[model samples]
Target: MAKGQVFVSMALALLVFMHVGGIRGEMRGGGEEGDRILALPGQPKVSFQQFSGYVTVNKVVGRALFYWLTEAVHDPLSKPLVVWLNGGPGCSSVAYGASEEIGPFRINKTASGLYLNKFPWNTEANLLFLETPAGVGFSYTNRSSDLFDTGDRRTAKDSLQFLIQWMDRFPRYKTREVYLTGESYAGHYVPQLAKEIVTYNAISKHPIYLKGFMVGNAVTDNYYDNLGTVTYWWSHAMISDRTYRQLINICDFSRLKESNECESLYSYAMDQEFGNIDQYNIYAPPCNNSDGRTNGCTRHTIRLPHRPHPIFRQMSGYDPCTEKYAEIFYNRPDVQKAMHANTTKIPYKWTACNEVLNRNWNDTDVSILPIYRDLIAAGLRIWVFSGDVDSVVPVTATRYSLAQLKLSTKIPWYPWYVKKQVGGWTEVYEGLTFATVRGAGHEVPLFKPRATLQLFRSFLSGQPLPTKS
Candidate 1:
């Protein structure tokens, strides 16, 4: 299927009522055997288990019931818990979190190789990646008539219910420090979920010790985010002054929606001067493959050779695809099963960038800014990271969205040296911090694995940003 049509189908599927009750029928019971969920057979060597059963959220009738992923390594008594959600309102946490970001494994482009990621985010603390608000990923409902028309309110309520059920399943970790993390559109998911957690704590008196949150190159505001992209292009010297002015003048920031038109506007700005800027072209169609016949291969092939060539260029300056992590993730059957993904169904060539866009999620609300403020005020550490080269949710957009907070700069911005003058820069203020990864686009981990690993380590430990000096 064409990528555009596939996205349209996914959007339509969300509109239809597909009963997902049967998928959770076997989720009864408790303990290791019950919790040690195994991935379906035929996946790579990674193995993970689901700890908590389903939670029914009666607060909202049409939108209820959600599930959470438990770390493969268990410590039921006294381990911190982290919950992760991918954006899209329909994208699977397993698809992005497990496969692309912090999960233990990453799939090879051809879906033939599985490699282990040395810095799987879960290594520091227990992690839980969830598909919330139902109809997303594997979390389903028996009510084929259930409403999948989800928003921040429904998602927050459903996620709260899921956490309540999760705690009940493993009571020992009830007091464990809980953190929420996500990327892309999850700029909406994290704050809303945190607010729900705080509200539930106030009323129930039994709260999931919500610690902090981390989001990467997220989408929070429409006007600033769109406008920032134009400035970012100019700052990076990818666009000319005339083209930037054209974008600022012609683009409708108010009716801002993701579509082919958005792609065209950005394309015009980038093509004004072609100096090999992949960031601008990240969302635009390739100049060579306008027919879409060669299938978005033009976009993916720009970084390295396709097909007979190595899928990943080794950062160690050796053969591409030589990293131990990539090899293990692609090859691990357990990780695949835990992800609950069907690699066979997806195209053999899968890059984080090549995934189908969610056309159905054109309208998103940004009212959750207050919730983020509340979390920061409550003394939770917040970290927002961005891949400077990612045009989808670029670093420029992040800065503009954060400017809405009106936060007092407690700590001034400074370079976060990764290796000599490499890595990137970081800024700390009050309880929140923002950082960017050098040479990395949207998928920071995929592009700069070692640097990303270091960033996570510093984030989890609450340690001061590392310096290469």
Candidate 2:
């Protein structure tokens, strides 16, 4: 054949090869087949596909993040992608976001099997739960110092890298609208990562389809969070009048470092005055199992700046301890092998939260409100919802921080209903929506699944929360 004829043949062959490999259009990565989860041990059979594996964010330092994608129940192709992160500065999204809050499977307390969550967010959209920053959950790093050096800045950058690479692996989702969601410290993670996505989209030939972000009881401004937390404690009668006055007069939250006196007072309130209560959900009973393991309640907290306070884990109901079950289920050899996790066989057992990483956290933004402002001005759909009963990152604190934005209220605060009953109250601002889950704690989905699902639906549709019954 002539040289021109041979060139045309080669070009056609290349196109065929790309199409067969699922790389047509804007798709650019591989490994989808290998990552497909056939069946997790003891998991209930479900129709939708599930994929979980690691995505290397850095080669030199050998850092990789783990992710579990639970596709939509009905028509995944028509659904948007929603990414969920949990904040402990070190908590595993696989544990909290996946097993307890929004993901489809809920681990049985016996750790022997899995059950379906009737209100799983995957029912509405494709859910992506990530264990990020290289030290959380099954995600790991070859370099030992990476654990000691992690903070908000590095976490956000690394997460952005993970997304860029992950989208390549599941290239079909490249064009799907993506929304970032998380709670607590993810308030920092979600917005900071959103800023990074917005920045990356401005310069990249193939940008992520980032739509917006929503956070629950997120840590926004340290000053406002601290002020609101103290106020919540006082208003709820968790502390004495004298203690409240002392906290207000002494704690200087504007500063990066809280004084020793401030720390002592705060610690005293939590330890002495707070009693044996679930700080995550004050109205709930504390898990008092002897091992602190049987009840499935794993203690987790987000220490802000220099204030270290112990808080409760995110589980369901009055005293449900679901995290212990997650730890047992995830650490099982068969389960890990099935999910493609712990491939490196790091020298440790999987835990819900990494204390070392959380303790050694190097830096924090002190406030994430600046990034929120930037994203809001960029016309992204930004929503901040709070589970009112949480004292750790209370609704009061969220209100205080958002008040600083001074966005004109487009819709006055009104009751939002689900199933003809008041689910919560919502108020729309010029570029943001603030809603409250009436009786929920820090983790809204865990505490109030149906209401949160309704909230989630509203967020995805870019519609206001239902004002009518």
Among the numbered candidates, top TM-score falls to 2
Q: Global lDDT of each model?
A: 0.59, 0.81
C-alpha positional error of residue 43 in candidate 2 after TM-score superposition, expressed in Å: 1.5
Candidate 1 structure quality by residue, lDDT tens digits, 391-432:
656788788878888888866777777666567888887778
Off by over 4 Å in 2: 1-30, 289-319, 343-347
Off by over 4 Å in 1: 1-24, 27-32, 38-78, 108-114, 142-148, 257-267, 270-357, 419-421
lDDT of 2 by residue, 242-345 (tens): 99999999989786667889878877887678777776778866555566642322222423522112334444442365776887888786787788765433
